[model samples]
Target: MKIMIMRHGEAEATALSDGQRPLTEEGINEVTQVAELVAEEYVVSKIIASPLLRAQQTASLMATGLNLPAVDTLTELAPEHKPESVLKALASEEAEVLLLVSHMPLVDQLAGWLLEGSRMSPIAFPTATVAVLHTDHLAAGVAELERVFLAPS
Candidate 1:
C-alpha cells in the first residue's frame, strides 16, 4: 500500500482556537493545484485527515480534485498527537493508495518514523506538501519514501 501524507494548506493566523483556523484563499488555490497534480499521477482510494478545520478543508479540496466522495477524520491525526497511534490505526487500511492530511511536527514525525524509525523528521513540509510512502506491511522503518510533492510557490 502507498500512504500519501500531506500537510494542510496555509491558514488564517487568528481564530477562536488553532483548530478553528480556516484556509487562506491562496492556500485553497495551491492545494487545488497540487490535488490536480496528484490526480494526474496517482490513484488514491481513501482520504483521511485531522479533525482541525484547515486540515478538513484541505481534505475536502483533495477529495474534490480526486473525484472522491468521502473524507474520514481521525482525531489521532491532530497536531498534539504522536505518529504511533495514527500509524497503528492505519495498519488495517486496505486501500492501494491512502491519503492522510494533517499538520507539521506530526507530519514530519510520522514521515521520520516511517522512514527511519526514529524521532528525527528529515523533510520540511511546506503547506499542502505531500509525501508518498510505500509499504507492504504497515510498520516503522519498513516503508520507502517514494517521492514528495511540495506546495506551490
Candidate 2:
C-alpha cells in the first residue's frame, strides 16, 4: 500500500477559532501547485482529512486535481488524536492508495509511528508538502519513506 501524508497549507494565524482557520492566499496557490503535481505523479484512491478548515481546504484541492471526492473529515485524524487510533483506522481502510491531510504534530507523529514506532520532531511541511510511504502491508507496522514532495516557494 502507498500512503501519502500531507500537512495542510499555510493558514491565517488569527482565526475565528483555531480549528476554523482558513488557508491564506499563498497557501491556496501552494497547495494547488502540489495538488497538480500529485495528480500527475500518483494515483490516489482515497483522501482523508482532519475536520479543520485548513486541512479540508488543502484536501479539497488535491481531491479536485485527482478527480476524487472531497476527503471525509474524521476527528480521529485531527490533531491531538491518539497515534494508535490513526494507525488502526489506516489499517482498517480498504484503499490501497490513501491521502491524508492533517496538522503538524499529528502528521509528524503518524509518520514516526508508521516508520519507527515512536514520536518524531515535527518536520516543517512548508505550506504544501507530501511525504509518500510505501509498505509491504498496510496493517503491518513496517513502512519506508519513498519520497517527499515540497512545493516551490
Candidate 3:
C-alpha cells in the first residue's frame, strides 16, 4: 500500500486553543496547489485527517481537489498523539493509496517511524508538504519513500 503523509497548511498563530487554529489564506492557496499536484500525480483511495481545524481544512481542500469522498477525521493524527496510535487506527484500512493529513510533529514522526523502524525523523514537513511512501507491511524500516511533493511557502 501507498501512504502519503502530509502536514497541515499554514495556520493562525493563535486561537482559543491550538486545535481551533484555522488555516490562513496563504495556507489555503498552498494546500490547493499541493492538492492539485497530488490529484494529478497519484491515485488516492482515502483521506484521513487530524480533527484539528487547520488539518480538517487542509483535508477538505485536498478532498475537493482530488474528487475523493468525504474526508475522515482521526484523533490519532492530532499533534500530541504518537505515530503508533495512528498506525493502530489504520490497521484495517484497505485503501491502495491513503492520504493522512496531520500536524507537524506527528506527520514527521509517523513518516520516520514508517521508514526507519526506530526514532528517526529525516523528513522536514513544512506547511503543506506531502511525503509518499510504499510498504507491504506496516512495520517500520520496510517502507520505501517513493516521492515527495513540497508546496513551498
Candidate 4:
C-alpha cells in the first residue's frame, strides 16, 4: 500500500480556534502546485483530511487537482491527535493509494512512527509538504519513506 501524508498549507496564525484557521492565498497556490505534481506521479485513490479548516481546504484542493471524488474527514488527524490512532483507523481502509492531509507534529510523528518505530520524525514537515511511504501493512517501523514533495516557496 502507498500512504501519502501531507501537511496543510500555510494558514493564518490565529483564528477563533486552532481548528478554524484557514489557508492563506499563497498556501492555496503552493498546495495546488504540489498536488498537481503528485497527481502526475501517482494515481491517488482516496483523500483523507483532518477536520480542521486548514487541512480540509488543503484536502479539497488536492482532491480536485487529483480528480478525486471528495475528501473524507477524520478527527484523529488533528494536530494533537496521536499517530497510532490514525494508523489504526487507516488499517481498515481499502485504498491502494491514500492521501492524508493533516497538521504538523502529527504528520511528522506519523511518518516517524511508520519508518523508524519511534515518535521522533526523521524529516521536517513544512506546510504543504508531502511524504510518501510504501508498506505491506500499516505498522510501526514497517514502512519505507519512498519520496517527498515540497510545495514551491
Candidate 5:
C-alpha cells in the first residue's frame, strides 16, 4: 500500500482552540501546489483528514486537486490521537493509495513510529509537507519512506 501523510497547511493562531483554527490564504496556496504535485505522480483513492478546520480545508483542497470523490473526516486524526489507531482504521479501508491530512506532533510521531519504531523522529514536519511511505503491513517499523514533498513558501 502507498500512504501519504501531510501536515495541514499553516493555520491562523487566534482561535479559541486548536481545532477551531483555519488555514491562512498562503496556506491554501501552498497546500494546493503540493496537492498538484501529488496528483501528477499518484493515484489517490482515499483522503482522510482530521475534523479540525485546518485539516479539513487542507484535505478538501487536496482531494479536489487529486480528483478524488471526497474527503473523509476522521476524529482519530486529531492532533492528540494515536497513530496506531489511525493505521488500523486505514487498514480496513483497503485503499491502494491513501492520503492523510493532520497536525503536528502526531503527524511527525506517526512518521517516526512507522519509519524507525520508537527510536526517534528523524525529521521535522513543516507546514504543508508530505511524506510518502510504502508498506505491506500496517504495523510500526515495517514501512519504508519513499519520498517527501515540501510546499513552496
Candidate 6:
C-alpha cells in the first residue's frame, strides 16, 4: 500500500466569519498545480482530508485531478486531533493508495510516528507538500517513508 500525506495549502490568517475560512486565490492555484503533479506520477485510489476548509479544498482539487470522488473528511485527522488517533484510523482503512490532506504538526508527527515510532520535533511541512509512505500493511510502524514532494510556493 502507498499512503500519501499532504499539507494544506496557504490560507488566510483569520476567517471573515466564524468557521468560514476559505483558501486564498494563490492557495487554490498552488494546490491545483500540486494536484496535477501528483496525478502525473501517482495512481491515487482514495482521498481523505481534514474538515478544515483549506485541507478539504486541497483534497478536492487533488481528487478532481485524479477523477475520484471528493475526499471523505476524517475528524481524527483534524488539525487539533492527536497523531496516535490518526495513525490508528489509517491502520484500519483498506485502500491501496490513500491520499490524506491535513495540517502541519499533525502530518509531520504522523509521518514521524510511522517512520520511527515516535514524534520528531520542529515539524516543518510546507504548504502543499506531499510525503509518500510505502508498506505491506497499514498497522502502526509498518510504513517506510518513500519520498517527499514539495510544491512550489
lDDT of each: 0.92, 0.83, 0.92, 0.93, 0.88, 0.81
Best by TM-score: 4
Task: Estimate the TM-score of every prediction.
Answer: 0.97, 0.92, 0.97, 0.98, 0.95, 0.90
Model 4 residue 16 distance off true place after TM-score fit, in angstroms: 1.2
The candidate scoring highest on lDDT is: 4
The digit string of per-residue lDDT tens for model 3 on 1-153 reads 999999999999999999899999999999999998998889899999999999999999999999987999998999999888888889999999999999878888899999997656788889999999999978778899998998855
Tell me the tens digit of each residue's lDDT in model 6 across 8-65: 8888879975235677888888888888888888889899999888888888888998
Candidate 5, poorest ten consecutive residues by summed lDDT: 115-124
lDDT of 4 by residue, 61-132 (tens): 999999998889998999989999998888789899999999889999999999999989887898899999
Q: What are the runs in model 4 whose C-alpha is more than 4 Å off?
A: none
Q: After superposing candidate 2, which stretches have Cα over 4 Å from the reference?
A: 121-124, 139-141
Compose the digit string of candidate 5's lDDT tens values, residues 1-153. 988989999899889987899999999999999999888889898999999999999999998899887899888899888888787777677889889999988889888888878636676789999999999988888889998999976
Q: Show model 6 residue runs off by greater than 4 Å.
A: 16-19, 121-123
In candidate 2, the residue pairs with backbone N, CA or C atoms under 3 Å apart (3 or more residues apart, or in different chains) clash, namely none
As for TM-score, the candidate ahead, 2 or 6, is: 2
Ordered from best to worst TM-score, the candidate numbers read 4, 1, 3, 5, 2, 6
Model 1 segments more than 4 A misplaced: none
Residue pairs of candidate 5 with colliding backbone atoms: none
Task: Measure candidate 5: CA RMSD.
Answer: 1.2
For candidate 6, the per-residue lDDT at 148 reads 77
Clashes of 5: 0
lDDT of 2 at 18: 89
Give Cα distance to truth, residue 8, candidate 1, Å: 0.1
